[model samples]
Target: MELKTRMDGQVAVITGGAQGIGASTGRIMAELGATVVLADVNEDGANATAEAINADGGTAVGVRYDAFDKDAVRGLITDVAGRFGHLDILHNNVGGSWPDRDLQVLDIDDDTWLKIFDWNMHTTHWATTAVLPIMLEQGKGSIVNTITGGAQVGMSIQVAYGSAKGAVSSYTRYVAVQYGRRGIRCNAVNPGLILTPHAVEVMSEDFKRSLFDQITTVRAGVPDDIGYAVAFLASDAAGYINGEAITVAGGGPRSSHDAEALRVGAYGPSVPAPPADLILPDLH
Candidate 1:
C-alpha cells in the first residue's frame, strides 16, 4: 500500500516559517498540496516566504505569531483552522541561541537562563498545548519539533540551550505516549551544523571548521534536509513513527579531541610500517 506524501486536503501551521528550515519546510508542504500557514515574528520574512510560495503556485498565508505568548498562540491556531476548516500538521520550529549569552549554567545569570528557556521550551509548550485540543477534536494530527544537536548529544558550552532542548525532547515523547491512542503523533528533528543563512553570517571560520571536522560529510547540512524530514514525519507514511527523534545530522559525532587534533594538526608520532619480508595472507 502506497501512502502519498502530497497533502492536498490538509492544512499545516509552521511556527518558524519565515526563513531557514521553517521557510524551506513551508515551501515543501505547500508544494505537496497543503494549505500552509506561515507564522513568525518576522512579518516581512514570513510574507516574503509566503509570497514566493504563492508565486510558485502553492497555497500559503503569512501571519505574525509569537509562540511564547499562550493567548496569541491560541488565536493563531483558531485563525488558521477557521480559514482552512482543519489543521493537520504543525512544525514547532521557533528557536534560536542567545548570542554570547548561551553560557554554562554557572556562568549564566537567572535572567539569561530563564530567557533561553522561554525562547526554546516555553514556546514549544505554548504551541503544543494550544494545538492539542484542536488535534483531539480533529481525531488526527502530527507535530514535528525542532531540537538541537547539543541536546541530542552532550556539549558543555551551551548548557542553557542544551538543557531547554532536552526538556523539549522529553516533552516530545510525553506527548506521543499520552496521545498516541487518541490519534495524535509527535516527533522531533535534531539538526547538526546546518548552514542556514544566519549561521553562514555569524559563524567564524574556526567555529565552522570545528563542526565540519566533527561531521563525516565534508559539507554542512542545509535547510532542505530538515524540511524533507519534517514533511515525511507529518505525512501518513510515518504514521507508525511516533515519539521518535530523527537526527538530520550528516553523520555520527566525532570525538572533540579528534576534531581539535585535526584542527591543530597535532596528531602524535606516526606508527612505523610493517617489514617488507612479512607475507600478508590472501585467502580469497
Candidate 2:
C-alpha cells in the first residue's frame, strides 16, 4: 500500500487549542481532513478558532474545557466520541510553566509544585484515562503529549515544571507500551523555544536572543513547526512510530555555552576560524 498522511474522516481533539501551538495544530489537522475539536479554558477563543476553520471549509468545533477538572475532561471525551463515533487523535497540549513561581527546587513552594504537576501531569493522566476505553473499543488511536526540552536538559529555573514534564515523558512511553498491542499508539513532541503569541508577549528580547543562540537553525521555531509534527504523528504516516518523544526545536544546542563562547572569541587567536556558514541570520 502507498504511504498515507491524510487525516480524512478522522476525528481529533486538541487540548489548549485556543491559540499558539494548539490552534495551529487544529488548523493543520483540519486541513488534512480531520474533524478537529479545539478544547481550551478560553471558551471565546476556542469558538473563534473553530469558526475560522469552518469558514475555511474545514470541519472543526471549539469547546470550553478545564483540563484540571477530571469530570470535565471525561465529559469532553465522552461527548466527542459519542458524537463522532470515534476519536482518532488526542493531543494533550494544555501545559505551561510559571516563571515567577516555579523557581529553584529549594526556593519553590509546595503549592507551586502541586500546581505545576496538576497542569502538566494530572491533565495528561485524566485525559488519557478518559479516552483509552473509547480508543481501545475501536482498536486504534494516537495520543500525543506535549513535552518540553527542559525535561531533557538541566535547567536553572522552572524546576517543578521540568520535573512534571519529565514525568509526562515517561508516562508517554508507558502508555505506548501498554496499549500498542491493543491498537493504541502513544507518543510525545518536544517543542524547543517555539515563538507563540504568549511566548512573544512574555519572553524578553535578551532571553529570546540567548535562546536563539542555542538553536541550530536559521530561523526561530514557530507554532507550525510543532503543528506539522503533531499532524504527522497523528496520521497514518507515523503508524509504526509509538512510545517515542520527537524533539522539534530546530536542532537544539550542541554544547550551547561553548558555542556561544566561541562566537564571542572567548578562546581568542588560539581557536581556529569557524565555518563561514556558521554565521546565521539575526531572526528571533
10 residues in a row with least lDDT, candidate 2: 275-284
Q: Per-prediction TM-score, please?
A: 0.88, 0.91
Model 2: pairs clashing at backbone N, Cα or C within 3 Å: none
Which candidate gets the maximum lDDT versus the true structure?
2
Writing each residue's lDDT as its tens digit, candidate 1 over 4-113 gives 78788899999989999999999999988998999999989999999999999999999998866778877888888888788999899988777588777678888888
- lDDT values of the candidates? 0.83, 0.88
lDDT of 2 at 86: 91
Off by over 4 Å in 1: 1-3, 258-284
Error of 1 at 220 (Å): 1.0
